[model samples]
Target: MKSFRLDELEAERAANDGAYLQFLRERNMSVGLYALDAGESDRQQPHGQDEVYFVVSGRASITVGTETTEVARGGVVYVPAGVPHKFHHISEDLRVLVVFSPPES
Candidate 1:
């Protein structure tokens, strides 16, 4: 069996310059930590794989397709494959736990 700690993953991500840090990957799914600074922009495009985001901390607004909603700690959002989505209007540093099905290319 394998295990991980969120604090450790977050620390690793903080040491990197990229906004996204992947911690685990398998044949069926992948997990990572995604962070966005306050007032920062999310320059991500639509993915080929379905994705899930669990807000670990902070607050922001996410636009998925034509809809936009506020997201904060303990919030969960899902985006289907090929759907346009991004985070904006960040009022605080946003940290999210990201999961992708069938891995991410």
Candidate 2:
């Protein structure tokens, strides 16, 4: 078993409006910590595996396949494999845990 502190991961530098850290990954799954500074919206990506997002702090707007949900602290979202999703219009200082199964390439 492996464990880590979320704050230690490399902060992903951005020219855009958010920051993230790809903190931990294993053979079957990967985990990340994400933060949105400002103007964070309209992010659409096709995922290769099932995903679970747990809000560590702050708020988020998560979208999956035409459905949208507003998630706040302690909120969680489950996205199935091959589903297209996005994080939209989030202006709050957000810290979220993103887990992906069968680790993407």
Candidate 3:
């Protein structure tokens, strides 16, 4: 068994490019935390594995493929493998939990 605290993880910066912290990795899946400050743009690329996003705080407009939708805290979004997706129009600090199935390369 394993556990993690977001606050603690946020204090540790794994990369300098963005507030993206990949916290867990198992044989079948992986988990990560992603955050963006208000007005910041998301520059993530499409993944090779299916993904699920769970909003932990704030609001934003998420674009998947050719569709865009507004999502906020407690909202969940799913993206299929190889589908293009990004977050924009961040109205508040955005924090989200990202999950990838079958692990990610």
Candidate 4:
């Protein structure tokens, strides 16, 4: 089994919007830690991954489907496969844990 401490992960900042640390991956799935600061986000298109996001710190407004939800720390959001979504925030930085599923499943 592989083990990773939080301090062992390399932190990478996006320079303009969100920062991410790619943590783990197995045969069919991967995980990451992402952070988005306020007013950041160029409204990019979704990259076609069925994503499960768990808020780890701060707050964010996530656009999904026809409605947007304000997600705070300890909240979870499910984004459907291939759907277009974006993250936005005003005051607090958005920190989250993300999981990506297997492609052929």
Candidate 5:
């Protein structure tokens, strides 16, 4: 079993590129913490693996392909493999938990 405290992870901001912090790695999945400050943009492209995003805090509009929606804390979003996605119009400092299935190479 593995455990992590969000506060501790947030405190490690210096080690991160203000984008993501990969916290766990397993045989078939990987978990990462992603954060974007207010007004910052998510410049990620399509992924090779399916992914799930759990919003930890803040608000933003996420675009997946041609669909876009606003998400806040406690909200969840899913993106299938090979789909284009990104977050924008961040109204607050956003913190999210990202999970990738089948592990990412």
Candidate 6:
């Protein structure tokens, strides 16, 4: 069994100066923390695997396919494989827990 602490992961990510820090990876899925500061842009492109995003904290708007909506703490979102998605208009620092099925090839 394995456990993780969000604060620890966040600190690691910040120390690495990276926007995302992958914490767990297995045969079925992968988990990571994604951070975006206010006025920053999410430059991610479409992925080959489905994904789920849990907003750990902050406020922003995400666009999946042609749909767009606001998200904040406790907000959850799902994106299907091959769909274009990105977060924008961040009003606060965004910390999102990202889950990708099939290990995010």
Question: Number of the top candidate by lDDT?
Answer: 6
1-105, model 6: which lDDT tens digit per residue?
999999999999999999999999999999999999999989999999999999999999999999999999999999999999999999999999999998887
Q: What's model 6's lDDT at 55?
A: 100
Instruction: Check candidate 1 and list the clashing pairs.
Output: none
Candidate 1: residue 77 Cα off by (Å): 0.5
**Pairs in steric clash, model 4:** none
What's each prediction's TM-score? 0.96, 0.79, 0.92, 0.78, 0.94, 0.98
Q: Give the winner by TM-score: 2 or 5.
A: 5
Show where candidate 1 strays beyond 4 Å.
none
lDDT of 3 by residue, 1-105 (tens): 898897777666434555888889999999988999899989899999999999989999999999999999999999999999999999999999999997877
lDDT tens digits, residue span 15-63, model 1: 8878999988999999899999999999999999999999999999999
Lowest lDDT sum, 10 consecutive residues, model 6, at 96-105
| TM-score, cand. 6 | 0.98
Model 4 residue 38 CA deviation (Å) reads: 2.2
Model 5: which ten-residue window has the lowest total lDDT?
Answer: 10-19
Model 3 deviation from native, Cα RMSD in Å: 1.7
lDDT of 6 at 47: 95
Could you give candidate 5's per-residue lDDT for residues 13-74 as a string of tens digits? 54665688888889999998899999997888899999999999999999999999999999
Residue 17, candidate 3: C-alpha displacement in angstroms = 6.7
In candidate 3, list every pair of residues with a backbone clash. Answer: none
Clashes of each: 0, 0, 0, 0, 0, 0
Arranged by lDDT, best first:
6, 1, 5, 3, 2, 4
Winner on TM-score between 4 and 5 is 5
